[model samples]
Structure formats: structure tokens, C-alpha cells
Target: MRTIRVIGIGTGDPEQLTLQAVRALSEVDAVFVLDKGSEKADLVALRREICARHAKAGLRFVVAGDPERERRPADYAGTVEAWHAARASLLEALIADELGAGEVGAFLVWGDPALYDSTLRILERITARGRLAFACEVVPGISSVQVLAARHRIPLNRIGAPVHITTGRRLAAGLDPEADSTVVMLDADPRFDHLDPELTIYWGAYLGTRDEILRSGRLGTVGPEIRRVRAEARARHGWIMDTYLLRKPGAE
Candidate 1:
């Protein structure tokens, strides 16, 4: 039987790799990396750097070109389903062609595998097809949410209050009043400006790395500045990973 380890390598810092992740890296016969294109070359480099830092010698590295997806299709759910199917097909082929019986392979995830990442989903699809036979193991890593909160020196939730974690799209629809604190991720839009000016925001981008940027203040005072800074950073780096926490006044 073949074995595949889905390991989380943390947000960005190489040192964030847990000892379990390090041991998993050492045992892998091959490491698979998805190339997202030249625009995000830094992302690919980070994965390679992690492998170089932790994996045992004589490790084989496989680089696969990621399938492009429609960014703004009319049917977002359908488009994502199709894209995932394509990715699963590609992964299935890679496993069959590259991994022999009893060999160990791995894919390093950017954050916790159970988070916003689709690698685990794709792997499940491949295994469910019954064409490839592999046992999978997961090793959790530090997530960007944890890193963001830690860097800001804040708790995710107020005392006995609930924290709502949602995407930028859902946030644009409406803010939940019951959620004392809301954490936003995958925010391509500046929806924070829609909230009351009295609300406070703590934001971070390119977290756990040298290029990290952080900002905090009342929404009215710092929202525009965050937007401007975010635009400049995206233009400079070709891509950005950011998250933020918002708190209503008197939320405790």
C-alpha cells in the first residue's frame, strides 16, 4: 500500500514547522509542490525552502503546475467544483505515475489542512475514485488566524463572547450583531469600510514573514489607510495573504 502525508507547513515562517511536521518530512520519499505561476514565485520558493530546511537528504521533489481557475464566473460554485475535479484528476495521475507501492509521498499545505485549503478535499476525491490506493496522514500546523491574533496581542474572542470567522464575501452581505468579534479572511474587497466608523479593526498581511504589515485603529480613522497599504503591497508582491479582526464598541 502507498502512503501520503498531508502536512501543514504553517503560514510562512520556516521555523513555525512543528516537530511532527519535521519528522513527517524526513520520512517522505517524495514531496509534491504546486507551482501557481511566476507571479507568486515567492510562495513556491517558501515551500522549497521548508523542504530544504527540514527534509532528510536525498529527498525527491516533484513540481506540478496548478490548474488555472476562473476568478469571477457567473456560477462560482459550479466553477469551483469543476476546478476541483480537474485538480483531483491531475493529482490522481501524479500519484499513479510517480508513487510506487509502499513509497511515501507528501504535500505541504500553507496553513492547517482543515482550514481554507482544498488539498485534503482533492486527495479525498482521488481516493474515493478507487483507482489509486493510498493511506493518508495529516499533521496540523500553526494557522494564520493564530499568528494574526498573536502578533496583535489580542484574544480571538471576548470573555464568554463568540467569535465569528467569515470570508470577505459574506462580510459584505452583513455583519452579525451577536458576534462580539469577527475575524475576516480571504477578503479581496474592503468591506470593513461598510461597518460603523466606531468599530475597531486589527489587520495583518504577509504574516509570519519579513514582509509582514500590521495596522490597528478605529475603522473611520484607519480603514482608508489599510486599503491604500494593502493595494501597494499587492502591487509590489503580485499576491498577498491577509486577515483581520473587527470588534464593535463596548463589546468587551
Candidate 2:
């Protein structure tokens, strides 16, 4: 029997790691962290920092290189599917080498595994390989949304208002068009430019660490501001995770 622990390590701050996530880290024999090579070394380092600060037991870490994401719509889903398969195969090999028969492996996910993350799904694909029957568990961590909300002291939704969480891709396509409040993530593109500038905006970058930046104003006004800040932040950090909340008036 093989078991893999899928643990969310939160955005960047070690303080953001949940107690349960810490417990899960202590129990795993090896922690697999994705190193997107030199450009985003900070991401892998964040997991290491958390483990050093909170891991009760000494554990091993394996830094796996992440495959580049497929951006074109024509091949996006299929490309992601293929990427998962490849990642699973690579991870399975590492798991097999470490654990001959029964062993536990942990993956330190950057964000909550349940939200916009695909590690759990890829782990499932690995289990279906039948080489080793695998069971998996998740340890949730603080997400960018929580960080953004808390930083701004704003409720995601007020009373009867609805909050829709979506990707930058969908927002660029005009969002649901009917959502009162929308939270956009994974947005490399400046999607706010496409929307009606009347929408109020709250944008956050590098959301939970020392270098975190939070800015907001009317959409039209801040879009350019965020674009400028976003580029500088990304250049400084080498990587960034940002989320924004936009609402057309009458949303709440």
C-alpha cells in the first residue's frame, strides 16, 4: 500500500501554514516540492522554510522540476492532462524508490489543493497505474482569497450578495457577466482592462509574505496601477500569486 499526503503550504509565509498541515509534514517520510527551476526558486524555498520552522521530525525533501504550462486554448486541457500524466510517472518512480512496499510521501502544494490546484488529481492518476495501490489525503492551508480579504478587512460577500471565484482566463472572456462579486486568480493577463471600468477593484500581489502588496480603487483607475506594480513585483520576486475582487455596483 502506498499513501501520499497532499498538503497545502499556503502562499508564501510560513505563518500561513495550518496546524494540521504541520502535523502532516512531520509524518511524511519525504516531502516533494516543485522547483520551477531557477526563475521561481523562492516557491520551493518557502516550503523548506515552513518545514524548518514547524516540522516536528526531520524529513527529506525532493525538489522536482515543474513542467511548463500550456497556454494556448487549442491544446490547453489536453496539454495539462499530458503534463499530469508525466508528472505522475516521475513522482511514482521517486515514490517507488523510497518506499519498496508500504510508504508515505508528501507533496507540499503552494496553495490549497482543493482550490485551483491539480496535484490531487494527478496523484489519483498515479494510483490508477496499479503498480502500487495508492491512497491520498489532503491538509488544507490558507489561500490567497483569505489573505486578500483579511488584508482589506472586507467580507467576500455582504448579506445576500454572491461572490464568484474564477480564473483570469474566464474574466478576460467577460466573466460570468452576471456575477455580482468575482474573485479572479491565476491571472497572468491583465483581465481588468476588458471589463467595464465602473467596477470597483481590490487587487493583491504576493499576498501573505513580507513583500506583499495590496491596492484598490475603481477598476479603470487601478488597472494601470496594478499592471505597473504587478510587473515590478514579479520581477523582484521572480514569481507572484495575485488575486482580485471586482464588483459592479448593486453587487451587495
Candidate 3:
């Protein structure tokens, strides 16, 4: 089996795709792209653009869907494990078919594969079983955090203040060792409703795409606005990848 290079295509912009990423895209003999669901059509389009820009002659292409995600049952822990298992199974098949023919394969990872992305971990599990033999490389790109800060033009941290990266789920579960700034990602639960929001908010959705929206203000003041904007964008585009940085008063 040939090595599979997992490429982080970055947010939704062609420019955000790194040079190294382009090279990886061109070099692979085959590539497998994930189609999570219909609502994520824009994501698939972004991959199409990448392939159009860098895919070279003789490179095989494959598209795969997530096997299935089981709803968390009463024993939530068990359900979570099952979900990972299902995803693992789907990826295993893709790897075998794409790489078994002695062709190098790659998967397009949204954002950087190292940041809260599970493709690398799943590959690790598959490789451990000896069912697949492959080398992997992660090509980094601009993250939403960096893009948000740039658009807002505000330092993510105050003098000597630390920043914590968390998700809407973790924030709702209860923030940990609270820092001066907390970055919220995968914001499905509208967690800002739980925060004071007076400190600051640098929110962005569909970052780098033409339909991108960015806003910043008091969380208490901008929370509803962000929600509205997020909903309208989701409705307009069928999907969203928004993030925000929140802070406590006087921390900035």
C-alpha cells in the first residue's frame, strides 16, 4: 500500500490552501474526499475547486460518505464509542480501495487535521491493525481563529492574558480553569447565551468564502445577532463553520 497524505484544505477558500497542500494534491496517485451529508454541499464544492486547481494527470479520485452516526443512547459513553467505530469502518474501506492498487491516496481534512480533527486519529487506528500500511503528513493552513482575529484586528489576548480553545459543547459543559479569552468552535448549541458577552466577541462564519459574515461586540448584545446571522447563512448556504472568541470583562 502506498502512503496516504492527509491534507488540511483550510477553511473554504482556495487562497487559504497552502502551497504544500497544493503539492500534496498534485502528487497523490488517488484522493478520497468525504461527503458528510447533503447540507455540506459547499464543502464538497470546495474540494472540487482544489482538485481543479492542482490535480494532475494519472491521479485517481474517490469520494466517500460517513457510514453512519448512532444517536447517543442512555449510556452516552457507549454510543460515542460506537460512532467512532462506524466512522473507522468507513475510512478503512476507502483506504483499502484507494491504496490497495499501489496508488498513493489522500483525504481532504477540513481546517487543519491536527486541530480537533479526527481523520489523523482514525488513520492511526487503521494503521495499528496492520490492515493498512501508510505514511502520513499534515499540511497546516490558516485556522478560523487566526482569520477571525485578523478580520476583527484585535489581539486575542490582553497583556499577560492567556487564551483557551474550546467548543460550544465544552463551554456548555462548563468552562475549565477559565482564561482571559476562550475561543469557541463547532458552535451548534449557541453557547454564548451562557456567557456575559460584555467582554468581546469576534464571530465569523464561512470564513474566506464569498458569503462570509463577521461581527464583534458584547456577547449579551451581539449573541442574538450572531444567532440570526448564523441561521440566515445556514439557510442560505446549507452549512456553516463559524467560530468566536469570548472574554471576561476587563480581561482585555
| Number of the top-ranking candidate, with TM-score as the measure | 1
- Highest lDDT: give the candidate number: 1
RMSD of 1: 1.0
Backbone collisions counted per model: 0, 0, 1
lDDT of 1 at 136: 96
Off by over 4 Å in 1: none
lDDT of 3 by residue, 50-158 (tens): 8878988877768878666544357757776676777777888877766765566888887888887878888887878787677777777677888888888888788
Residues 33-103, candidate 1, lDDT per residue (tens digit)?
Answer: 88999988898899889888888888888888999998778898999999999999998999888888999
| Candidate no. 3 TM-score | 0.91
What C-alpha lDDT do the candidate models reach, one value each?
0.90, 0.81, 0.79
RMSD of each: 1.0, 1.7, 2.0
Model with the higher lDDT, candidate 1 or 2: 1
lDDT of residue 27 for candidate 3: 81
Candidate 2 lDDT score at position 90: 81
